[model samples]
Target: MSRAAIVVAAVACAACSGRMPVLDPGGPQAARIATYWWIVFWLSALILAAVVAFLLHTLAHRRVAAAPASLVEDTRVERRLALGVAAAVGLTALTLVVLLVTSVATGRALRSFGGTDPLTLEVTGYQWWWDVEYWDPVPSQRVRTANEIHIPVGRPVLVKTRSLDVIHSFWVPGLHGKKDNIPGHGSSLVLQADRAGTFIGRCAEFCGVQHAHMQLLVIADQPEVFDAWLQAQRRSAVVPTDAFARHGFDLFMTGPCALCHTVLGTPAGGRRGPDLTHLASRRTLAAGTLPNTVGHLAGWIIDPQAQKPGAQMPGNAFGADDLSALLAFLGGLS
Candidate 1:
């Protein structure tokens, strides 16, 4: 259809809709945008109403045909109009001040509240994945993991953000907001959950070719469950006793893979990419694009460029056996 027709159709559809549009008068972050819009809407409506009222009064009392030679402006009417204009401007300014103060207060509260002792996760964003490290100070331990970040519900969780390559973003809509991960410059996000659930987050900023693929997951749970998960993540690297996985482990260690990737208890300590200390424990590979399974892992290992074009990971020469062995070893890293 033509542009004019599309515009007319959209307007007609909107006119026929019955639901009240959300007027976000005040909230936080993007939610506060609606509040600003609502203020504009009401201010415009009031101004239009005043203009229409004045025009109607002028049309009723003022002479249309030019017959009177000594028509004079009324001082009282002029003063009333000036007062109305002043009031409108003052009210608009006051509204803006209130909105700004409220937003500042909300942000301060979100930053300061300490609901309970919470888990701390250090999440580093890479070109195509997220490297997650669970740090518990009380237990005096650290657990290296991948894309999925776990926390305890009803607690204030602090997340530290860093980037290995370019800048990326960490965002979880259901819980809080987005924070950028920049190289050399470290940022932090303090978030909390009201209840227990799995909240999905992603790299909100555009970092590179596979920027869209950089996803992260946050699992909020009870304290006990979170502790158990910590223990599981801290377990020694999975050594595949099976023939294929064993061969894959050997191939991974002896091949060029060790130069860029790191498996905590193994020889593959290539720090160029995300430290895959607990690779298999992660939900997705390729920075949260694909699941951490044999198929996706194998495919990514074989041809990372095909899976994520412009990925920093260079796909080198490898046969089926070599690829299979590498996949097995990486997959068993947890």
Candidate 2:
């Protein structure tokens, strides 16, 4: 590809999920994986270099040495060649053993998490979105949100995942390895961030057309900050007070928007799509396909297919006034 096209692609990817540096881990689990990766990489590089050097040395020796007279069969030379072959075989076996042991150790370390106060999340993978449910012991205290997930820094997060439609894998290279979300089976991933920052996650498995657009954000925050955010999410959506917003709420409840999306503490509860209880609170919309802004949201509502092909949400043809009121109400969902 041309340099300009490569630059454009890089910019688009950055806009979608920033830089995904698998080697630059942000957590203990990812660090272990990265360590294993470097071990294998160096071992392979060394093996390649050794093989190339041996080939060059053999070629040079053949050119410099005279031809054997009458094919003299020397037992000493044959024994030396056999010993060298055996030594090379032994080294290869040792390398294989090292790789096997490290693989097992990394896998075990990733699965070894049983903290007393680890936060649990039920993350369901959809066709092109993520359904995140903060699993609380008390059912009423549970909070539901979409793509944006916040976890307390320096605490383990146990994520139980399953797929609602086709198989999808949840992967945040900055935190952990890929864990597939099978339809009939459930899997769990334990991740912990050592510092406060945002990490990008994506559906690692190929599910459908919009798989490329299926992205999520992992926000690591201080314990107190995460607690406050969770508490805020647990509350219901604020009832609009102004005239236009109230009218927009009425329109939302009485229109097609109520059929797929849910707004907590209201009659407009629908399960097919992402919950809009804290819609404006999220950083992105449609599983990170578009930024969560007024103009982008308006454009998505008017024509979702244009933004993301094969999206489940259909386009609408609302009048300009209705569209403004709808935006006014939805924009204040925070």
Candidate 3:
């Protein structure tokens, strides 16, 4: 391929990657932000054009015979120039005031949480993953999940955020602005999706060696679908009925795997790691580090540190048959 063809292919690949979320607004908050951005962008462009035109005009008239010595001291011309400068300054001030007011109004709109009934989600940022819990007034209604969040379309969601170890940021650029999750403190933000789609989220603040891997998915679904998903999440993990799966389950519960992770409705209730009750239901493993497939799951279980250098979970040593059984059991949790 020619150099130009290669360059075009590279650009096409980057465009297909869907990485520029800020430019593609998916919610009301992000739409408002995009509007503000465009306003400033156009205003800046106009000012730059004006400056460039003035410079070009000056260059074109550079040989106009340095203002006649007599006209250089003309009080009337000086007065006119002074008036022109004053007018320009006043106009600039007015523009600034307008921009300021627009910014303040947009900020207020973004911060407003005025829904009579909003879904509440408690998000706690861990070193390399997000611990997410769907909150409810009834204790039993609360559902615990990790890495992925589901919300109903056209409804407001109040997200309460905090950090367990260090400062982290919750940011879904297509949905809203970044909110800090500070340790020893609490912060909250409101997000609402205008349509049904899947959006990606990431930890904007640096936390540790695997900070870049701290990613999540925000799924906006129809009301019925979202409710059904919530109901499923609130239930315990499905019990395996196959003989191999049962054997794997026994090994998981009796071995070191149960020491850090929890499988709801089972004897394992460890809280130091992400919940495994709905592990197979998630799209990614190790917090978006790998696709949630049987091969990836087995690899992660055998050697987690190789995938994430600073991950908290340690690798487990299991024979080939035992590893296959364990993967089968975990994959059936959905």
Residues 11-92, candidate 1, lDDT per residue (tens digit)? 5663231222234111133244344446657766876887799889988899667765657977897899999899979977
Cα-based lDDT for every prediction: 0.72, 0.92, 0.89
Q: TM-scores of the models, in the given order?
A: 0.75, 0.94, 0.90
Clashes of each: 5, 0, 0
Model 3, CA-based lDDT:
0.89
The lDDT-based order of candidates, best leading, equals 2, 3, 1
**What TM-score would you give candidate 3 relative to the actual structure?**
0.90
Q: In candidate 3, which residue ranges exceed 4 Å CA deviation?
A: 1-20, 64-68
What are the per-residue Cα lDDT tens digits for candidate 3 across 92-154?
998799799989999999888449898999999999899998988898788888999999999
Report residue 77 deviation for candidate 2 (angstroms).
Answer: 2.0
Best by TM-score: 2
Model 2 regions more than 4 Å off: 1-17, 64-67
lDDT string, candidate 2, 140-198, tens digits = 99999999899999999999999978999999999999999999999998999998999
